[model samples]
Target chain A: MNEKKSSAGLKLCISDLSMSFGGVQALEGVSFEVEPGTIHAIIGPNGAGKTTLINCISGQFIPEGTMHFGERELTHVRAHNRIQMGIARTFQHVNVYSELSVLDNIMIGGHHRLKSNWIRQCLYWGPYGCSREEQMLQAEALELLERLEMRHLADSPAGELSYGQQKRLEVGRALLAHPKLLLLDEPMAGMAKQEKKQLSDWILDINREMNITIVMIEHDMTVVQTLSDQVVVLDFGRKIAEGPPQEVVKDKRVRKAYLGED
Target chain B: MEPNLTDKDAGTAAARPLLETRLERYGAVGLILALAVGSMLISSYHLSLLTTITIFAFSAMGLNLLSGNAGLISIAHAAFMGLGAFTAAWFAIDLGIPILIAIILAGIVSAGVGLLFGIPSLRLSGLYLILATFAAQIILYWFFEQALWLTKSPDGRFVGIPEVMGFEFGDPWHYYLLVLVFTIAGAVVYLNILRSGLGRSLEVIKERPIVSQMMGVNLQRTKLIAFTIGHFYAGVAGALYGWHLQFVATEAFDLMGSIELLVMIIIGGLGSLAGAVLGATFIVVVPELLDMAGRRLVDDMGLMAPIRMFIYGLLVVIFLIYEPHGLARTWRKLVRYFNKKLFKNKNEH
Candidate 1:
């Protein structure tokens, strides 16, 4: 919020974050800072706790450390309440409501933002009631779909879409929440080169235009190097290197952990 | 489905804005008129049949919202109905409340009970939730039989002639109108909920609970609300049933009755409102159909009963194996087919 390098979005601060599943440690003493409005990518090889780190930040897992989003501490926040504080996330795999229409799937993402409750929703026919709210949400969903180039698939069930489309649908769903901090787990997973290129462009557009800070777990080092402003390399649940993308990717520890190097 | 352009025609029927169209404006009025006209045209015996179907359909619609849409199964819905019926009886006989007011109040009482039972759903789901609700069915059924204060007797308590707004419902036709009004209201509410964000939240919670929670849907609150509303529907149906038979009994709210409600929603279609209505009608008519078939086809009474029962079991199997989605999906397919043909003809014209 200060003269902190074009920081219009929330500053995400994670310090000494550690988590374990019983005997197996998923993340350990991992720490990183995501500058506001910056595209911060968490990259690692298999079993490197990149997804775990994303989950911890999104309040899926309670890790041992401090996670501050702007002024508030999100260490003990419930998963449902996380989005209320402008923290929205996509799953590593497709976790969208596939049974619902693409538009409805996105509309449901903004459920917390909707003003109508049980009474208003049940009695939706009063003067300027839930019906009006529904129309507004519907329009917003359609617009988001249009942006995603999925306007034609608005009425189609999410299950009917291609794997790449489903991934994009998940992103669009997360976007509908209007989160200040967007956590994307493998946004380019199962995508073709062309699809990845398009998604990378879209990510940059979302960061610059929407002023949302993004923390993404990416397997593709090429994408990690190209798209991210900052990069954190994790090897076996520990942060190996963290800096600007170019600097971190060139680090000896990062190269040893990520690429096949001595 | 067409592989083509036309951004102007991007909207599908589902994509259309909820309740924004002129057709949807008069939707409630149209629904009431249909129910009223349908009831008026039926004879006494048919009126009784229609009323029974309507009452069951009303309850199944409630179950459908929970089991069908929310993906939460409850085998204790009949007990909810029983609770409502008994509560209505208490209001009418003990407190001297208006039957109409009593019915609504009875629903509220059932809803409260539903919320109590729905607590187990927070930690339990799928088979566990079913078992939990099954326990609810048994426990609530026992309460109905033993609670002398409500039931008045082990046999049953007879509900008096239901009077609403000075109009006594002594005639079967008069009572049928009351049930019709409630069923219409149920259908309307069911539709309204499905279109609204609240309904969509339950749906998301059903399909993807983690994602739903991450999206900020309070899982516990949503599930409880569903149970409360779903039980209210069951309760209203029970009250109507009580008034229809002039009796409220534990026998009617037993485990078998709960299974019957479950079958109604499953056979009709899980999530479809029409499925709830159709399933109720199917269940009500099937027994009458079996009896009629048995009498016409066989001479010996004992043999006829077994033969009819075998056929009934066979029919259920055939429906499940073939139409797993239920009657609503089949009905939708037929409607879609007819619409397509109609559109083709229109194009030619």
Candidate 2:
């Protein structure tokens, strides 16, 4: 495992990453670097271990690799602390606090970023209140909700919303964490065509407007081709192609691997 | 954000202030009426029994905070009660602190000790946490037994009755009113806390600890707070218990007593205050009723007195198997059924 250093605009860099689950190797010497302010997609067919690779980068697994985030080495960092260091992720299964209101759900994402102590929150008085800081977080969260067009459901419980709405809210939550690098795991897994289009546009808008680099695991080739600046194609836990989406999607190995050459 | 209000929230907000202000006034009138009726009709023995029932209700209310809302299956609650009782006794006997002050101090001390046990178990969860607290009970119980200088070595002696402003709480009726007042206050405070962030955090931790951790909820702090606060109530109950009993001992707060409290919460309902009261009432009253019937049956068939205990044990088993959610859910179902049936035409779409 070789640790790579990130330049000024580099978002995340991974080198010589290998992870094995018992007898099976999920990722074998996988390497990729995502530049800041771009959409980087990792796409693969069924059982290709695309998600497993993303999970490793997100610090869900202690893989045999070196991961660097904004000049900081993140290979040995825990999942929660990795999140704290501006690397936030959304789960594939649209995990949101169902009992909490949609706004509260997003606010929980901002909780880790909050610098106030428990005493300040408990007392809630002048000077220590840091009303400005709190308002800033709220403003940012509300703006994200408004941009996603889910602001109307802010007061409603997240559970009461439709599945598509829940996924959007989970993304909004990840965004609220103030991530420099957002790793989205199958954001368009189960959605109507219109919903998928809306989510795709939102993902692109977030990257362009917020200047947050996004590394996404997408199964939809059309979505990947449209939204991603560059695509990393993985098959059977190994990268088969890495280049611009047009070049990588048309590569013989990728075409055969994705479409069954046999 | 604008305070987005649902219909339920709007209705509750409108009704709550009125409910809050009027409840005590209405309750006072109702209580006065009930007292008049009871004093005129009921016997003195039954009145004494009612007093005991009220005190036990208070103790159960304390247990409800620990078991009901927090979802901690604590078997060391009775031990907490004993800690409170012994603390009160020692304070009154040694320092000559007034009973009210002693009770408050005892509660604080008990909460501190509960935190001491709870902190260690914060990292370890579920049955492991239970085992940790069970060890606390054993250690605390052993200390009470062996520490002859404080507890006078197991035989147990009577503590002085609390006399406030020359009014001795010698009668069961006097102590009953005092206990009921504290109990109501405790219940109200508990309810308020349940509606607050503290309560929400506990529910979050109970339902999904990993999610709460990810959301930056301090798991150790929350667990410690719950444990300490729960035992604080238990401690208060113990003071009232000791005052009511007029004695303190190892036998009063034993493992069986702790188990009985757990049974009360389990048989009542795990997560509701009403369930705790129901369970406690069932535990206290049902046995007496069984004993009365048992005496008659024994006279007729020459059965043993231990048959009542057997019956009680069997009822607990049956309750756990058939109605694990306890009588609270039964009451909820009844209410829902009535609402749907009687108010069908009135319900808005």
Candidate 3:
């Protein structure tokens, strides 16, 4: 495969990262590079360990090997700290603050970058003044909300949104973290065909407009075909195929893995 | 992503009442104002009871932050308060520290002890944490009773009255005002913290600690803060209670006292600050009211009146099962129901 040209000023390099729970190895000797400003897809059937790989990269597991975003080592980083390094992810299933307003859900993602101290916040008056910091954070959060076409539901509780809307809101939240690298786990899962189309368009828009390097795990072949700049297939926690979507889709092993035949 | 928000929805809509209510944080402020004004008008004895209720209410509010918001139940808050009371007494007696300064020091020292006990919470939870607090109550109660070098052994009455700023705090009225100021201020800070980012983080931890950790909220740090703050508030309340009565013993701050505070929160409402006040008032005043009713019944109808404690216990259980949302939710529903029935909107008509 050709070494793809980098564009979004980020190249995530993972080498020999492995993890095990008890005696069962979740991932072993997994190595891959997601080129900058491109959609790198990881596809697999049920229990193929796609989510585990995402978990490892997202700091949920302390892996045995190095995972680097640009030049910084991510193998030992905490999940939230990774956001500051421009790494963000959405769960395969929607994980969001249900009781909070849609706007506040985004604000939570923005909280990582907030500079306000507890002292200033507690007193309601301080040397730095919490009101000023709070207003600015709110402004930024509302801006991200509008971009995701969720401004109308800003005040609505996040749980009130439909599945598709919640998915969009999750994406909006990840964006609010100001990530240069976004890992979307099954962004198109459980969405209607039209909803999938809308989400796909937005994902592409984000990549094009904001130039975010997106590493997505998609089960839907149609989504992978339409959106990914490159594809990497995993099965039973092993890399099955890696290349452009057209090349990877035509591979015998890739077809057999998806179709369940040799 | 940088999303441009300035170009959209700048002034397109009227603010919803609910959203405005969140922004205004009217609940805490409104409750304090109403209670303060109401307290001033009551008879002096009731005013004293009101002061007790306020102190207990603030203590409950602190616990609510830890137990209700942060999902760490505590049964040892009263012990923390006891520590504060004795610390203040010891300081006032041995060091001759001013009452206000002593109270502050008591809160700080109690918070230090609270921090130590809270360390176990990093590894313990639920009934285990409750058990840990029970152990704390027993240990502290023993120390208060037996530690002669520090507390002068039983009958902890060596502590003198507190006077500060040239104003004697020995008077019931003076102490009541002092309690009122501190309780109101404590309630205000608690309300703000509940509405702030820390509140969200606590709720997040309560619902999903792993998710909260992944979201970048430090679980141990957040919980430590909750435990310390809760203990600090309880300590302040105890210190104030000690000085007001000018007499305190192990009996004043014991395991049953901790249980009573828990019952107050549970009966009033678990998560609502307003419920803390309602619960504290109910716990403090209802017994006296029942006693008066019992005496009247015996005098007029030739019946017994001393079964009030049994009735109070029954009320707690019934409320727990029947209206688990507590009196605050019930009160809200009643208000809303009357508002709808009494004042139908002209638009609806």
Candidate 4:
């Protein structure tokens, strides 16, 4: 099956983003540029503001900074509108709608693309009826399921899925948005070794096949080292190192921060 | 590696076949048949009882969508209903409009009111949202009492028997058919909406607003839609109530009425359409049944009111303790049992 890559992904530029909660600063003067069609990983220890940076980019947390996606300013863009602009993110925890069927969960990710009006939807008329749009949505959602190798689980309630499967489902949901830039927060966390390998392979395939840029937060050093094209290391809400994984890992500050050396 | 199935998976798997069985397919047919049999077998007085149940069921279904599906509590649902009732009455009497058109107009007016009150829900949720709806109830009640021109009920407003295309619906049997048709239509609309994208979005919003936002759901728009549709159902029910009683009174739609509607959805099953019907029947019929039983022991209607209220309170408490998911879940369980017993062989293939 052929997948269309829209816009070849867009550059994401974050300039001097600062965020604090009460007395604790989560991300301070954080600046970075994620080039189009590349896997960018943000790695840091606990409370290092890695997740906070993702939140700021996704518009969940407003910070003192300017953000640009492609040439479009996104600092004031609402969270819901960010998806329409081809930016999608998953949660630190697997946050698929637990009560919905797996198919429905994926279909929801395609909501911004469905153009059926409320009246047509209420009456099941026009595109909202048993028409092209309806069929297309179902087909697209099924294709997404097939891509994740989760076609058999489409009818199952999402919450009933195992933790590893839920994480995959979350990724599939974000992919359904056809995002130019995908932000995955701990996508491989809490997975078994086999499951982690499978997820890493899927993430690699998603990046290479779909040509979608990715910004991910992961503590799995091995996966980050193998998959990331660029790595940004954070400590105490500050960027400690920004380079390729091999060099960043060898950096003195990164090693000291990770090993907690005096 | 073998798939890891949790207890929830086991439970849902056990229940899945029941939902998919032939019996489930016939559920709608069964409901229609029951309504048909009821209309044919019951006496005029009992037909009135059925009509009242059907009317209340409409309002309860609305509340079910708002409180059950959307996870937004509304104590002002009856106020939306009351708005519909008064609007229909005003249209029918003051403007000399047709009753059918008046009923439709009433629904639209109530939807408008619902949209107005729903603004608060976009910013508030849980207890705060509930409190806001309660304020709506009080405000609407005060509006009904003070706005004499709108209500035209200084004492109590008497509405003429509704006539649609020269057919008088004053007779219980005739009104029963009307109410039954409207109720069924309302149910069809409710069920259809649930299958729609808008309905799914509302569920997403209810489950996780942040996740929903990430999934591109407009939180404010979805909430407003839920409120509008839910209250449209209420408005239709309220107009039907006016036709049933042929009278309008401010006291009929007080906070207690709102609470009663909420109770119906709670006892019937929140978020289930069948539960809405079951709850409406329970709230409406159970009280009359109790009143009949109580009348044998007590003497006056005035004295019986308090006894009825006491019984309702007791029943709600009992339901909360034992069947919190409400009668709909109980009904589903019973159906599942029968389906398993009757269709076990057929389903195994």
Model 4 per-residue lDDT tens digits across residues B1-349: 0011112222222211212457766776787778877687888778878888889998888888888888889999888898899989999999998999999899999998999989856799989999999999999999998889989864547887889998887667778788888888888777766766777887898999988987899888888888988899888899999889888777888899999999898889888888899999998888888887877988777888888788888888998999988999898888789888878888641
Question: Which tens-of-lDDT digit does each residue in B233-274 have in candidate 1?
Answer: 988889999999888877989887888788888889888787
* Winner by TM-score: 1
Candidate that scores best on DockQ: 1
Note the Cα lDDT for every prediction shown: 0.84, 0.72, 0.77, 0.84
Pitting candidate 2 against candidate 3, the one with the higher DockQ is 3
Model 3 chain B — which ten-residue stretch has the worst lDDT?
A: B15-24
Please compute DockQ, using alpha carbons, for every candidate against the native two-chain complex: 0.42, 0.15, 0.29, 0.31
Which residue runs does candidate 3 get wrong by more than 4 Å? A1-8, A126-128, B1-41, B293-323, B331-349
Candidate 4 local distance difference test against the native: 0.84
- Please tell me the interface RMSD, in Å, for model 4: 10.0
Candidate 1 residue pairs in clash (backbone atoms < 3 Å) = none
Per residue, candidate 4 scores C-alpha lDDT tens digits across A1-262 of 1133445678999999899999999998999999888889999889999999998888888899899999999988988999999999888988988988998898788788777766666666444452345446666677679878899999899999988888888888888888888999999888888888888888878888778899999999998998898999999999989998989989999988964664
Q: What is the TM-score of chain A in candidate 4?
A: 0.94
Candidate 2: tens digits of C-alpha lDDT, residues A35-115: 877789998888787878777766667899788887888888766576677777787886787866787677666766656
Higher-ranked by TM-score: 1 or 4: 1
Q: lDDT tens digits, residues B1-349, model 2?
A: 2112112222211111111223333544586458545644567677666655555556666666666666666778888888888888888777888888888888888889998888778787778877877888888888788777767667555786787667898765666667777776666556544433455556667766665554555666777778878888878888778877788867878877887887787787766666766777787788778768777766653454467567767877888899987887786676557666665775431
Better of 1 and 3 by lDDT: 1
